[model samples]
Structure formats: structure tokens, C-alpha cells
Target: LGLASCKNNTETLGSPLPLNKNYFENYLNARYNEEADYDPNSPANILREVHGLNKQGKLITQVSMFANRYPSEDALKLFGANEGVGAQLPQ
Candidate 1:
């Protein structure tokens, strides 16, 4: 199903697809593939990232220091968090 490339190259990420083909780019958008391959709502294949807890600890969150990603630093600081979400919807 896949082919290996540069076996001695440690810096490489993973095995290449094949001649003139890319599996990740082609199958990444399939919902059934992602759910069946991994699990429910894994977010591994998602591109839009709203917030994420960089640390694995129970009370830790890795919010972006920049303004656009998350602007609610106060709520995050309540638990030493790092990020939050800011979405506006029309009524």
C-alpha cells in the first residue's frame, strides 16, 4: 500500500507514497476514512484549530500568545491555560 524512501535518512518524516501519487492529500478529506481509520472526532486530520491544550496535564492549556487565536486570557489564567475560542454568530 506504501513505499519506503531513503532508509538511512533520519530527518525524513515517513515513507513516500508512490510515483506521482499522494495518499494523505487525497484521503485526508474523507470523513468515513478518518472515523474508521482512527476514532470519533480525533481532530488529527482537521485543519481549523480553535484552541488546544499543549500540555497533557489536567489543568494546563497551550493557548496562543497572539491576539487573533484566543483573546480571553483571563478565563485561561483561571486554570493556567494557554488558549480560548472567540466565535460570533448572527442572531
Candidate 2:
């Protein structure tokens, strides 16, 4: 019964959205519990992170840019595949 309920909950949540500015905002909120303020648009908040926002404000980090033109789960998969294959990337 618990497993079935959890499945239904996940189904109702729908498909996951790609990593984007809004997602980053929510993540920061959850991670810091609103104690440490973070601005998703600030370079300081994004520079050291795994994701980056382009001029148009999308999570298309320097690394993921080579994988796909747009941000999506498939892009992440492609990036992972490239890493797995030991693709040489610029420093």
C-alpha cells in the first residue's frame, strides 16, 4: 500500500523539468533553508556550481554546452556518455 501510494504521488508530480534558473533557485532555498541568501543570477552563486546560466538565462553550463544546444535530461545523459567515453575537453 505504501509503495502504491508513493508511485501515485510521483505520477501526479509529472515529468521532471530540466535544470534551469528556477530550479536552481528552488534548490538553493531547500539547501540553505532560507538562512543563506543566494541570487541565482549572481556570478558568485553560479560560477563554482556545476550549472551555469547563459545570457538568455538557461542552465547550459560550459561543460554541458558541448553535449546539447538546449538544457534537458537528454543533455545530461549525453554529457555523462561523453565523460564515460573519456572525451577530451578543453581546460
Candidate 3:
């Protein structure tokens, strides 16, 4: 969401960490349309309610949550991004 969430020099506004912009847009649009039409759990619900908050530009909001969801380093680095949003940051 901001510089605070960007620890990787390779990640930035221009470089979006290889996320699907279409899914991201759909995810953002889903926030406004909450119903069976946007069920996050559905694989192909036409619209998703909440797949990965990262797809909605709110990864920062789910930073801690993702950590618990993905505790392993390799796991977190994969689907769950650290982006300096875990439990540490340079003071």
C-alpha cells in the first residue's frame, strides 16, 4: 500500500510482484459487490469475495494475518508476501 510495505528493492508501483492485474481489479470490484456473486471461496464464482487481499491492494491490512496463515519462510515468500509488513521494520 505504501513504501512501508516495500522491503524488496525489486517490488514497486511499476513492478507489481507478478500479480494478475485482472484478478486484482476483480478483487477490488468485488468489495463493492458482496453476494454469491463474489464468494471468495469459490474457484469460479464469476467474482471472488476474498481470495488474497494482496489482489486488492490491501495486503498491508492482512500482513499479520498472512504470517499466521503461512508460517514457513518458503511458504510465506510464495503466496504470502512479507514486504516488511510482518513484525519487524527499521526504526
Candidate 4:
């Protein structure tokens, strides 16, 4: 992540999106105590797998797929749990 100049005096900084990937990996590693089986349906797995790709579009797509596969309430709960309160999944 790098800083960039914006039109205004305020500057734009690189996003800390990769932190989500790191957090997911750490959670899985700790929970499983070893390499966990790859679960495509798992949001953590999706984030971990896509982390290296460094493509925001791809990451968003994977998250969308995960949300689509589950009920809205379940998805929202899972998202909020991982991403913190009031974090809304894309519609």
C-alpha cells in the first residue's frame, strides 16, 4: 500500500485491506492447529486464497459469492463478526 496525491490538500493512503487476509489466516492457523482443509464456502478461506492476488475486484467477488451462498441474516452475522459491528455486506 502506497500513498497517493489527491486533488484536494488531503492525501489518499493505500488501503489496509490485506489486514483482513492476515487476520483470517491467523484465525485458521490457530483454530486448526495445522493446515486446515480448503473450504471454498468459507469466507476466511476465500480471503486467504485471494490475498496474494492483490485485486480488490476479485476479493469483492469472492466475498459476494460467499454472501450469496448463505441466508442474508447468516451472511450479515458472519460478516459483522469478522469485520466488526455495522459492517454491511454489499447488496
Candidate 5:
């Protein structure tokens, strides 16, 4: 019964989304200087940095939510992806 319940729960959750490689790459490029000591390719390192930053009491504003919701190429380009990491968003 326990095993069946677990299977049902897993089925309900469905599969996780695939990692957005472009987002990761662009994010890495932008934050590389800020995390120079850690290996950008290491998932553990990336998670650690992100978690650390989040723990610093970062608040989620509406603009951030909007950016996350539309992280496609067009959105990224609008944020100056061509200008490289840490580029300022268009006014």
C-alpha cells in the first residue's frame, strides 16, 4: 500500500522541466566575476552560490517575477544578452 501511494504521488508530480542551458550559460557569464572562486560548471557550486545569495534576504519583486516567467531568447535579448553578463536592462 505504501509503495502504491508513492507511485501515485510521483505520477501526479510529473517530470521536471529540462534545464535551460542558455539561461544557465548566460547567467554564468554574467555572475562569473562575482563567483570567481567556484567552478561554473559544477552544479553543486552553482546551487551553493544561488542559495547563499537567496539567504541574504533578497526580496522577489514583480519585475523579477516577470523576467523569470519570460526567459525566452527574445526576453533575454531585450535584457541585453548581446552585451554579455551583468549588462544593464534597457530603460
Candidate 6:
């Protein structure tokens, strides 16, 4: 995430882009403790996971992940609980 200067500044910062190079290969190297993907094929599960991940607690982590250009969260918010670690930092 080092600063770089290019003659062209047409590209917007933070625009969602695909990882098209090896440079980003290690970005998720420290990302661990992924929350369970409850039911990959179930629409209900997909919605639930999205809903859970967008809750305030999880949203904080999501924000950091994007802002910092990496998975910065150290823990996962419980699916439906108020407070508890559902998972831990990447190992």
C-alpha cells in the first residue's frame, strides 16, 4: 500500500478492481478465522450471512478491510449474539 505517483490521475482511488497481478497475492496472507459459510447454495443462508456481516460490529471490520486494503479484523461477531467471538484473527 505504498504511495505512488503516475502521470495520469484519471483513475479513481478505492475503485473496486479485480486482482490482476501477483502484487496483490499476499494481501490476504494474514486473513484467518473466516466465519462459516452456513449454506453456500441456500438463498436464505446467503441473505443471513450478508445480514450478519453488515451488522454494526461486523461492518466495522468490513470498513477496515476496505480502508486498509486488507482483512484487518481480528474477530468475528457472533451470528445472532450481542457479544462474543465467533472466530479469531487469521493464523
- Best-matching candidate per TM-score: 3
lDDT of 2 by residue, 1-91 (tens): 3543344232232434334665456545542121234456566656645454332333322321232234465445443343324333345
**RMSD after CA superposition, every candidate:** 25.6, 19.7, 18.4, 18.7, 19.5, 20.8
lDDT on C-alpha atoms for all candidate structures: 0.33, 0.42, 0.38, 0.43, 0.45, 0.39
Q: How do all models score by TM-score?
A: 0.15, 0.18, 0.21, 0.16, 0.18, 0.15
Better of 4 and 6 by lDDT: 4
Alpha carbon RMSD to native, model 3: 18.4
Q: What is the lDDT of candidate 4?
A: 0.43
Give lDDT for model 1. 0.33
lDDT of 4 by residue, 1-69 (tens): 998867645343333332344445555554312233444656665676678543222221112122123
Model 3 TM-score relative to the real fold: 0.21
The predicted structure with the larger lDDT, 1 or 3, is 3
lDDT at residue 45 of model 2 (Cα atoms): 52
Model 2 misplaced stretches (Cα beyond 4 Å)? 1-19, 31-91
lDDT leader? 5
What lDDT is obtained when candidate 5 is compared to the true structure? 0.45
List, residue by residue over 1-91, the lDDT tens digit for candidate 3: 5555645455343433534555446555543222222343445432333443332211222221222222344433434244544333345
Cα lDDT over the full model 3: 0.38
